[model samples]
Target: MITEKAPGKLYIAGEYAVVENGFPAILVALNQFVYCSIEPSTNGTGKIVSHQYQNNAVQWHRQGDQMIVDQRDNPFSYILSAIQVTEEYARTLNKPLDVYDLHIDSELDSASGKKYGLGSSAAVTVATVKALCQFYHLPVNNDRIFKLAAIAHFAVQGNGSLGDVAASVYGGWIAYHSFDRQWLAEQRKFLDLTTLLNLPWPNLKIETLTAPANLALVIGWTGKPASTSQLVDKISLFKARQQAQYQEFLNASRQCIQRMINGFHAGSLEMIQTEIRYNRSLLQELARRSGVQIETPVLKQLCQIAEQFGGAAKTSGAGGGDCGIVAIDAQADLQSMINQWTAENIEHLPLAVHFMNNVHRYTIKLK
Candidate 1:
């Protein structure tokens, strides 16, 4: 059996604007993860099992090179996409396919099956792709894994900056610039999977960052799950209606994220926190203009409490209600802030940054 894991991620800054090509976002992979384990099947059939879904395991079979499955099981979408895409790449290498039973388990959600706004889907997709690459004896590196997983994830999710996929595959602190999805969609019409992976994706960039030594990261969960896609959709609609306002938001977000990236490079905790506060304001203005509740009332309280405790905080992702992140001086009174959060019914999640040392070796060529 081969097992692989991908860490869940939280967006640090650059949320709504990052979806546009060449826009940047900062994200960190958390210690929480989704694990995928696969082993060869002797019965000539393959099954996917996940404890999250209880008894709804998906049974699938190969029809030629295509994997056929019941369309009713939505949970298998990401897994199946990963399998099909990886198998396609395998075929490009003249490698043969075999039946395997794959099992998935995740720490990206609460015990009661509520999502914590961690990037579980992206992590699961990356884990599946990595496990299959290992299982197929493929020569895989971080770049290969990220590109493959991004392709699989995009095929299913159909939107977003794919920064979560990058954070999952590369781990640690990363500044990610999104590629042109329209260009990628066009390329997929004629390019083979291997060739596509090798191509320089336009405007795509992923750079690992180093946080200040004394910087402290804090996470608080509001216990309210939000639909990221739905929020994104609403933002998209707002963009369609208010093009000028949307453009201004994008430009402001780009500048704000660039400053934050500079802070990361310089190892300046103060600069980082300053930019975090600014980014929070930017998102709030965006929520007002777009008329989407990117930050809920509880989330506002969460950030305010962090501010009172001398930490900079904001909603982590697309943010209707999920998790908020904070950056502060390590010597500050973190426990007091956490205690206050508890008083407000916020759950303080003790998640650390998950780092994969080797991911820095993978570099992308710009087009």
Candidate 2:
């Protein structure tokens, strides 16, 4: 079988602007990666199987017009989108191909409890695209794979930024610049200190350990399987309506994150708070447009308490729900605060320097 693995990602900036006008987005691929295994098929029986162990395994067969999905738990859109993208990419490369026996295995946390903000969907789609690369023996680079993955997501949703896919493919801090037309990607690599793709800052020590002394974070679930598209669509409408405030917030976010970048380079964790506070205020503007508290009641209380201790907080993912990061400073008890919130169904998923290794080939042999 041919195999390929892809990483999950987190957005540091430009979460909403990613789909429009090439907003600057900073993303790092987590160690959590998705794997795909495929083999040649002999019979006309096209079998697609996914090992979701806890639930029933989904099996599919190609029908005259469409695929007959047997298991309902697994969404059919993802499968169809993958196949469609695979064919399109192969055609673009002028490579001959055929449907094959496919099996996907991932160590990504899909179980309910360990659900962090990792890009599980992006990871899976990247794996599928990589499997196609193996099948066609195509000389696809990370950028090209990103294009293919973006196309798949566009088909799945309407607009999808390549931020998640790029980090997962490139494995570092990707400086994505948005122009009038397309987004350009630049790899952030520190020349001397090598940590196997950790993208370490030249002056910053990797083991500074104290966890952003100025930024204590608490990420809690909104207890909803939020529809990301709906929120995005609403955001588009909001921007169109509140053009000035939206633009201001975007600029504030940009400046804030740029400051954080400079702080990292300068090895001064102290400077991080101003920017975090700046970004948090920008996101707060979304509430007026959103007309709903994307921040849960409990989360709101948590943020209130955090502010009482020291620093500010903001929802990390899409504003409507998911997870958030709080800034902790000198006067705050971060460890105790995190421990206190853990019992309230809030999880403290540690963030570390994640890595991704470049692959030029795959060697598959019969056992």
Candidate 3:
């Protein structure tokens, strides 16, 4: 059996604007993960199993090197996309494919099956692709895994910045600039998977970031799940209706992320915190203009309490509701903040940054 895992992620800055090509976002991988394990099957049939779904398992079969499933929806969509793309790449390598039972388990959600806004879908896609690559004994690195996973994710979702996918594959604090999806779509019309993976995608960048020694990260859950895609779609419509304001938001977000990146490099926690606060304000403005609630009342309260405790806080993702992140001094009154969040019915997630050693690093360049 081959097992692989990818960590869940939170957007530290640059949410709505990062969807545009070349826009930068900062995200951190959390210790929570989705694990995928593949085992060779002798019964000439394959199964995909996940306890999170309604049915515990879905059976699959290989028909002339193609894995076919009866139901392709929701959670299965990402898994199936990963399997198909990975198998296609393996065929490009002239590698033989075999029947295997794939199992998935996730800690990215709550015990009650509520999402924590930790990018579970992206984590599962990355984990599935990595597990299959390992099973086929394909020589792959972080970049390869990331590319394959991103392709699979885009095939299903068809939108978003893909920063979560990068965070999952790289497993650390990263500054990610999205690639040109239109370019990718056009290339996919004729290019093979292996060829596509080898190309230096336009505007795509992923760079590791370091936090100051005195900085501490905190996460609080609003216990309300938000559909990121729905909020993004609303914002897209707003962009069409209000082009000038949208561009201004994008430019402001780009500048804010660049400053935050500089703070990381200079080991300046104050600078990072200031930028975090600025980013939050940018998102709030976007939400107001777009008529999308990027931050809910609960998230607002969460941030206010953090500020009262001398921390910088903001809604993590597309954020109608989900989780809010805070960056604070390591010696701040974290316990008091947590107690206040508890009083406000917010759940404090005790998560640490997840990191992987010897991963490939990209240079930081903001466009």
Q: Which is the leading candidate under lDDT?
A: 3
Clashes of 3: 0
> Considering TM-score, which of the candidate structures 2 and 3 is the better prediction for this target?
3
TM-score of candidate 2 against the unseen true structure: 0.73
Candidate 2 clashes: the total is: 3
Clashes, model 1: 0
Q: Which stretches of candidate 1 lie over 4 Å from their true place?
A: 55-74, 361-367
TM-score of each predicted structure versus truth: 0.94, 0.73, 0.94
Per-residue lDDT tens digits of candidate 1, residues 1-367?
Answer: 9999999999999998999999999999999999999999979998999998554455567999999763322447888999989999999998999999999998988988888999887888899999999999987788889889889888877789889999998888989999999888889999988889888899999988889999999999999987787688799999999999999999999999999999998999999999999999999999998789999998999999999988999999999999999998999999999999999999999999999866654444445
Candidate 3, residue 189: the lDDT equals 95
Between candidates 1 and 2, the one scoring higher on lDDT is 1
Residue-wise lDDT of candidate 3 within 1-367, one digit each (tens)?
A: 8999999999999998999999999999999999999999989999999997655344466899899763322567889999999999999999999999999999988888878999988999999999999999887888889889988988887789889999998888999999998888899999998889888899998899888999999999999987787688799999999999999999999999999999999999999999999999999999888888899999999999999989999999999999999999999999999999999999999999998876655564322
lDDT of each: 0.90, 0.57, 0.91
Runs with alpha carbons beyond 4 Å of true place in candidate 3: 55-73, 360-367
Per-residue error (Å), model 3, residue 334: 0.4
